[model samples]
Target chain A: MNDNNSMAYAQSDTAQNESAQSSPVQNNSIYAQSSPVQDSPSYTNMPLLQLNDLCKRYPGMGSYMSVFHMNLIIPRGRIIGLLGPNGCGKTTLIKMINGLLTPTSGSVLINGMAPCPATKKVISYLPERTYLDNGMKVSQMVSYFADFYEDFSTEKAYGMLGALGISSDARLKTLSKGTKEKVQLILVMSRQADLFILDEPIAGVDPAARDYILRTIITNYNPGSTILLSTHLISDIENILDDVIFMKNGSLMLYTSVDSIRSQMGKSVDTYFREVYAC
Target chain B: MLGKLLKYEWRGLRFPFLVMMIVLASTTVLTCSVIYTINPNYNEAIPWYSSMALMFSIFLYYFGLIGCSIGLSLIIVIRFYNTCYTDQGYLTHTLPVTTRQILHAKLIAAFVADVLMVLAIAISLFLIIQVTLHHILSFIPEFTYADLMWEISRGIGEFEEIFGIRIGLYFAYLAIYSLIGTIANIVTLFGCVSLGQLYAKHRIIGAILAYFIVQFILQVLAYFASLPMYARMLGTSYNSDFSFFGLMSPTMNLMLFFSVALAVFMYFANMHMLTKRLNLE
Candidate 1:
């Protein structure tokens, strides 16, 4: 068989094995690649994000690099929780995947394509803090996103806003901190994308608001879309996650399926994260 | 993309732009009144027009200062103020837009605002000239009936003679200059702040100190860098025999090109740091 067919066969085999371990892919996820004209109409399996030998370095005191080489792969249709303490490179990894922070060496592929403007179109991101301009009203902010993103559904965005009881006319500056975070989340979740990288989505919220945010994430996430939710507060999101990627000091310490961790490590993901990252 | 950038830039500066307009309008009215009061026979006096010319000359300096101040303030607001890197960088770097696009948007917006500021001053001058019609006519009765048209033509001639270039070229060069100026400030601001914010060792204080140090070094470099251009503008290249506009045309054009190149260099450096090495928490 040719290179294309061989690659397709290998991909399918990997997907089948992965599916056996996790939830099945759901319909409605935008698939850009075709699987060599499927003869039996079977869905082809593909990883949504693959990080190979990724490295980032910042010059530190007298020639040391702050962040070292690291690697991890995030599969499709699973909530992969990235747990680490302060300065562990969780945010950096997320930023790299979203194309904000580029790797010093190695490569990262989003849906098998190099990070570019086109790849960004399929990645939804909610930053840890409010990034929206404080001067803008909710309506203006909505229109701004709508102008750029073709997949941004204004109707759905407003519906979500209404459901959350947020005023469309309220300026971002006037909103309370929790409310502002919700506004940002609304904007992020509004886009139907293949990958959603939420960097510390619930870090600043109270327990109640954190629960609300978690619920919002679970319900709003498009099926078949991969999610990499990075947070130190693992217990809150532990029940929903299918896998956990633990990082420390700019290195990947552990990457395993949740069930495997429970079966082997014999501890909850939260307990595992705390033990691994505890100071 | 440029248009969107300009739109957002304008959105960001709506308040400042309005304030600039009001300042221009007041200055225009005040200047006209002062000139009329000084020369009651201003309409008949040719020398009275000198004051109007002098006002524009003064405005030229103000334009540069205001442009620089606004650009500096914007840099602080967008890059330095509050000085949190983690949250801000996350949002900024992931906007589904290229780093270059973001830079272009900011540069264009700042340029447009600066241009409008200059225009506000120019428009105010035009209105004053129009309102002082009778006074201008009475002062130079020999050039009456169509003296307004004559003054306009003369003004155009004077601009060409003094600068030794066409008005179109002059305006284009100015636009380029303002754009580059804005880019420079933005780069310096972002680079320093990002460096500070990302460094786990020290944050805002370190960033600010680094910024000042960089600024001082750049200023020293810039002084030497500007020596050739300053000599050109001040030297014999400023031909007194030529029309007012022709006297310094080459120097102005050269300065414009230099600023643009410098700005582009700074722009790339800033983007490189932001995209690759940003230590967003």
Candidate 2:
């Protein structure tokens, strides 16, 4: 696996239940270990996500790329950590995945389709910023999620809200910042999506809340769904991640399994990230 | 999905609309009261202070109505910008909907709200006139509300004699034009905001500039299109035969076509920017 740099991360620590054989990597798609092969026959031959020469350049920024020609394939059911320094295009890449931003050069194919309405159904995204309407109550936000996302579980959302001691009747504007973050996190984590793309979920959150969030993400997500979380607090989330993607200057630097990193490099992802991205 | 989007859009809009309605209703009542109770006619010989207060009330009432109408438009523009372009756009864009769906929902919602506002203001004005006239006409022995309405209906016929069209038909045409115009206006505002977002560094300023430029261009086009017709009408007006509807009909038809074309152009422009050129910061 280590020798095959392009397909190094196809092995999974938790998705070993599948008996499917390894398929050849197609169109330079980011290959990951197969899981839930029989869950959907149409996507059985397809990777969960395929990025082909994806490039994005923002306007008014000359000779600079927000996301350079990045190619990656993320498989289903592994929690992958998207690690990068500030302004390293982690968010930009994630936005392209979720269709919040358009790519300049290539394509992002999800579940054998482009990033259209169907793709959005399978990708549950929690942006770094709080996107909840402040005028709405926590309960109304639940209704909103239930209305838009067919896979969203209102009962699960309300249960999590109660477990976190968040009042459903409380308006979002009245909640503390940390509490609002928790609400947004709960809204995202409550969905039963095929892919959960969380951008900086634990950033700006307290240590206790971070622990709770990481725990919730690990325990609550469907074992059939993949999780791609982006954050700078690598050490805090390093243990839960099955794979790690290191981005530098809007390009993919290294993408491999955490186990491979440990066996070959003899270092934690956090330490390796520091040495690679040190200023 | 467009229905769901419209539902949420109206949820965000209702509070502002409510406030506007309250202001409109109170000012309508106050203006009506001042008209009858204080008698601020120049020759009535009322107290100077009372007359000043009456004039102030009148000014506020008129401006208040105008402000509410214009304020509704601003609210629609700001709502479209905030939900579709700001940090909030992260959720909106990620929804399992197309860019056209979102734009269409906003257009329909804004058009409905605009029509409601116009209707409310029109009803308030009608009430003030009707109620005040009813009170004033009570002292006259033979003049009743019915009689006034009959006279008004006949006066509408005289209006036809001059304008060469029935008052009802005129109002029907006006209503149709206003409704379509409202939709075009909303689409243009949203299109401007979408166009502005492409600027990346200066979205608000870019949007404002885009609005001014669009307005100026539309004005220039309209002037050129209407100049010949107006010259022809003026040439007719000087000959003691008013070409009121003739002047209106041709230009109105031309503007109606222009308005639809502009809306379609802006809609496609917005769709292109949203789907292909999304630059959310």
Candidate 3:
């Protein structure tokens, strides 16, 4: 709540310099042509996202930091996994990144600027819960997205609905829970944003749906955009991730490449997560 | 963006409002028809059940007319709470619009909706009164609407002579007072809903408690604001020279100032909560 001194908006140069030191992906070969993680450190190549000394706390929780002083630097075109245990501030981090919650301290710079409406235009977010009104139809939601986001593709949204056999004309309440999740995912994936923050996107769906959802996410996102996904089901999304971030107690424990985790420890990301977050 | 937000907000509300208006209009017509059928020439008492049914219908009609205004306020408050502080808030807050735009849109929509409800109520009341008075006055031979008009105007003219002010000006003051008061009440409700987010759990209960606390504070402020007016009236009463107008302007000004101040305060408080302390589950 101390926004006056708690947060600062650094120029895009500040993010460029910090990103050069801590690019999420150490190697760019994973998605050879897609990610420009190896771009030169300059204003033109400013990181897609940055967090500097970010902190968030609930006043009623007696100084409990939901997201403590954590810093992150994400370059464009990489899919990063944000893995954390329960109450480890994964959603809190995502909420701040999407400007749903103001940071108690520090800064969240998207494309080197603060999280404003301008930044929001480039970030497509799928929250952990269903955010659509059940009274509306799937088609109405598609229309709403198209109305708000210039980059939204109504044609792609309807095509995905058709593929899933979900009638866009049906009211959301008339659909099953899994179908609603798919509808949300389709709407989010249809956007041509610079960053896609998907929080537990696959948690509510069947395993079959999870694979399709992940695939849809991988294929639908424009190459220039970065997908910062947070989920506990690390195995489901491990393969698609170019980089991985582990958080604990509201702090960043590690930020490195999926290749590094597999090569250095000879363990899959899921197995490593099991060991790191074991209670 | 503000326009877009308002457009969707109205679209979301249009169905419920339409249903309410249809119900209200149907009730008004039924009440007038029932009144129209009452026998103005009957000298003997009617059956107890029949009389009771007629009285009950009229009572229900007036009750509904009053409820429409209150219902609109409740509807807006609940909508504000649900869309801004519930699961739906995830989409609301993430929209590519500033918090100020969102709050202003909500406030404007609520204000406009309530104004429409008040207008509906006013029209319904006028219709009901005209119908009921028609039945009552039918018994009087050669009594006309012009006669009723003159009666009311004469009373207003006498009051104006004593008050030394135009009756029209007095009504204007009352209208402005009401409009400002409505804005203030709606903003306070929004502020209470925002305050509910302070609770880590049980936000609805927090909102209910905040509403009671706010109402109590407003009541206390209102009482204090009226003290000077009461003193002026009380002093004039002892001299036997009291004019109601002596109380009108000062009371109107005091209440108007308090309402404007309250509205401005709560507007800022709600915006601050949305921007800095929003809690969504």
Candidate 4:
């Protein structure tokens, strides 16, 4: 809540030192490295999130895996888009990163630590659904977040709520669906976490609300933090994305930058995504 | 973090809890009013209208009391399922707290709510009984609150002499047993829900089945556990060296021990499922 605490949360010392030592754009080269297992010597510079041989298979499903043998690293300070079709394991991957679901095999590490309370403290997550208690008023929700998340800025949250013309006294059940989504986004973006994972942030909102939601996400997130936005609506958020990770059939198909996808592929990311994932 | 979790948990549950309290209080007041209104002179038959009104009031009072008592626990259980393992779990499980911490907060909140409900019911019952006794004793000339207290104390003394255990200690044991029993039931329900969620389909049905299976197992254990007590009771009669401690202590201690063990096991089992085995649909 204070400037010192906010600064501490906004950027970890290692991240600050890494940023000062080399530009994040330069560190993007690390993605070219082969998938490293846990405690690999190649993992000198810790990515914000790293998944190694990650697989999730439901029981009695006869070997049909949801997310299979996925190995990837998500760096900090970049807005990465996790693009995939429905049931492509995008949400499952996100849930694994957020510790919502455990992987049937392998590991997901946040800041060199597995998804635990320590990692959870630095990872702010917005689920795809309206997960708030309907009985709670907007102000009560704000208080709840503040009480639980030390990095949560009540002032910024209220300011965003005000800009959206959402009354703090209004109960969640009384709010429209779009309004509730906006509130969820506001609550998520209000945190000064090192990693922000937003799942389908703008899926069902109107164009204007979608624009507003994207703007809120862009403006409110801490600079040194990473944002992983998952949505099928790639073009709408393509401009804001620095990197893109294409997932298909529970495996990582591509992990590259938008610029590379554009310059090398000679097409927009969305167009490229359509071509890659075309059935 | 546990405290914060508890604060929100309490906030979420406070509405139903307050409503239950209000219902109990209102029921107690209605009961007292009915008792006060009913004529002591029943030697002469009461009017039909008055009798009908009295019957309705009494029925309504008891209905409200029973309904709130039953509803309070049901609401608590449903709220637990809804908040911890339902869609709302996305918000809850994402908070920067350990699964154990979250479970602790829920368990503590539910335990406190159960305790409060029990206390409210106890107080309401005592008030109703006290008011009814007061009204009934109005027929006698020299009845007072002090006399009432004296009578209670004398009854308790007589009970202690007969049972060969101190009244306060007996009540304390009962309270401890009740608390442990409530916690055991709650944790077992949570364990069932957690286990049920492991199924890929028909989770609620799975939960119900889990409940029945767990209840059956517990009943079997209880039967085995009470064997010694049953044997002791059967072998001895009240006329021949009946020891209250010997006759009752083994069963009570075994039950207390079992309940405590089950509560711990269920707590850990619930935490394990929430942390390692959680799959939120």
Q: lDDT winner among the candidates? A: 2
DockQ of each: 0.39, 0.71, 0.69, 0.62
**Candidate 1: share of reference interface contacts reproduced:** 0.55
Name the lDDT value of residue A22 in candidate 1: 28
lDDT of each: 0.65, 0.81, 0.80, 0.80
Ranking of all predicted structures according to DockQ, beginning with the best and ending with the worst = 2, 3, 4, 1
**lDDT for each residue of candidate 1 in B140-239, tens digit (9 for 90 to 100):** 6677757667777889877866666778888887776666666665555655655565546776776777678766766666666666555655665655
- Model 3 gets an lDDT of 0.80
| Model 1 TM-score, 2 decimals | 0.72
For residues A85-194, write the lDDT of model 3, one tens digit per residue: 88878999999998888899999999889988999999999999999999999989998999999999999999999998999889999998988899999999999999
TM-score pick, better of 1 and 3: 3
TM-scores for all predictions: 0.72, 0.90, 0.90, 0.89
Q: Which stretches of candidate 4 lie over 4 Å from their true place?
A: A1-44, B142-151, B243-246
User: Which one wins by TM-score: 1 or 2?
Assistant: 2
| Deviation of model 4 at A154, angstroms | 1.4
Which one wins on DockQ? 2
lDDT of 1 by residue, A1-279 (tens): 123322322332232223212221111111122211221122245457766666666556443332344544565677778877787677777777777666778678887787887888889888776788787899998988887777888998899899888999999999999999988888888888888888899888899889888888898887778778988788888988877766655655555567766765688888766655445
lDDT of 3 at B118: 79
Q: What RMSD, rounded to one decimal, does every model reach?
A: 9.4, 6.3, 5.9, 8.2
Candidate 1 deviant stretches above 4 angstroms: A1-46, A61-67, B1-6, B30-89, B129-250
Model 2 misplaced regions, further than 4 Å: A1-44, B40-44, B139-144, B237-242
TM-score of chain A of 1: 0.81
Displacement of residue B256 (Cα, Å) in model 4 is: 2.5
**Alpha carbon lDDT of residue A30, candidate 4?**
31
